[model samples]
Target: MTAIPAVTLNNGVTIPQLGLGVFQIPDAETRAAVTTALEAGYRSIDTAAVYGNETGVGRALAASGLPRDELFVTTKLWITDLGRRAARDALRASLDRLGLDRVDLYLIHWPAPATDAYLDAWQGLEDLYAEGLARAIGVSNFLPEHLDRVVALGGTVPAVNQIELHPALQNRETAAAAAARGIATEAWSPLAQGAVLTEAPIVAAARAHGVTPAQVVLRWHLQQGRIVIPKSVTPARIAANLDVFGFDLTAAELTAIDALDRAGRTGPHPATFQG
Candidate 1:
């Protein structure tokens, strides 16, 4: 089993630097994918209600036979679940599906700024944290302004801000803002949906290190202090993704990759996305 490094959250909770993400994975395939990842030494699993596969994830966890403390699971509340009562109910439903009493981290799936209820949604998360239903609460796809608003609203500073990030979309400003407020930046599309693997910089770096382009990219995220979740259902790829802790990227290689950033984003814009 690879000894994946852990990053400490704002509230003293720690998360594995690398995890398996079940985004876009079919419900029938999620269990096998998660099981492959766990057997490959992955201790963290990121899922959400929107993914519609939490039930499969729960089954995998139960079958893995890994102790609760040995695994880190994360799930999110959808935009419709904003506000105190709705948020709590949504989390309970998610817990029931996940077959867990609590999650390591829970996040607002999106700012959904158009609805103007993120503040209320965050407050609900705060209540959950207080009630010990969630060890750490945070937001996802939030821009700097949205994060600032949450901080000003007062409660717990988000333990993390999960967003679409990769070499093509560096998202430096959002990351900087989160850093200033002691929030960890987690990369959702860390590989750019396999769009970056063939880029010259990544390919060259992979060649130089005798590793795969995907490994190089994952290493880049780790070197930059960003937690990354790369999703894959293929057994070989799932194991390959977790094998990134073996090498380090040189400063110049990191810079070359950084220069590949074109401010391109594969997901919805947080500033305008309603759900």
Candidate 2:
């Protein structure tokens, strides 16, 4: 088991830099997957209300027997639930499903700019945090303008901004903006959704590093200082995602991965996001 690294949030909370993401895993499979990840030494778990598997994730956590403080749990509010009243109640529902009294991190899943409810939603989250339901609060898929709006609303700056970031879509400018505000940017599709596993450079790097292409790609994310949540339901792949601590990428090798950036994004664009 590789030792996952940690990063200090803007609020000084420590989070495992690499975590297991339960994005599309079904309820039936999520429990076993999270259990496998935990046994493989992953301490952070990322899920969302939109994922519809929080109950299974909660079951896995309870079954692990690890103390609550030893694990980092993150969940999000869906765009459909983006009002002050709905947002407040949404956290409660998510908590009930997860069987956790409070979450390590909670987020507004998307800006939903067209819906124009995020500002009040931010206020709702602020209230929830003040009332002690979330240890830290953040956003997902928020671009610079969206972040500025949240900051302007007089709430604590979001502790993180999770996005689709792989070598194919590095989002350096967005990342720098988050850094400027002391918000840690997290990568969701950190592996390019597995589409780049066969790229020539990644393949050669894999051979030279005596590691798999997936490992090389994940290492690039780590070296970039981006918090990454790579998901897999298979037990072996879950273990493989966590087994990234033994090697370090050379400066040139890191540069090679950087060169693969083509402004390719496998997920939604922030500019066009409705949520």
Q: Which candidate should be chosen as best, given lDDT against the real structure?
A: 1
Off by over 4 Å in 2: none
List lDDT for all candidates, in order: 0.94, 0.90
Candidate 2 local lDDT, 130-226, one digit each (tens): 9989999999999898989899886699999998888888888888889999999999999998988888888888899899999999988898788
Residue 171's lDDT within candidate 2 is: 86
Candidate 1 colliding pairs, count? 0
- Candidate 1, residue 105: Cα displacement in angstroms equals 0.3
As a whole number from 0 to 100, the lDDT of residue 148 in candidate 1 is 92
Model 1 alpha-carbon miss at residue 140, Å:
0.2
- The digit string of per-residue lDDT tens for model 1 on 1-275 reads 89999999999999999999999999899999999999999999999999999999999999999999999999999988988788999999999999999999999999888766889989999999999999999999999999999999877999999999999999999999999999999999999999899999899999998999999999999998999999999999999999998889999999999999997889888888876
Task: List candidate 1 stretches off by more than 4 Å.
Answer: none
Specify the highest-TM-score model's number.
Answer: 1
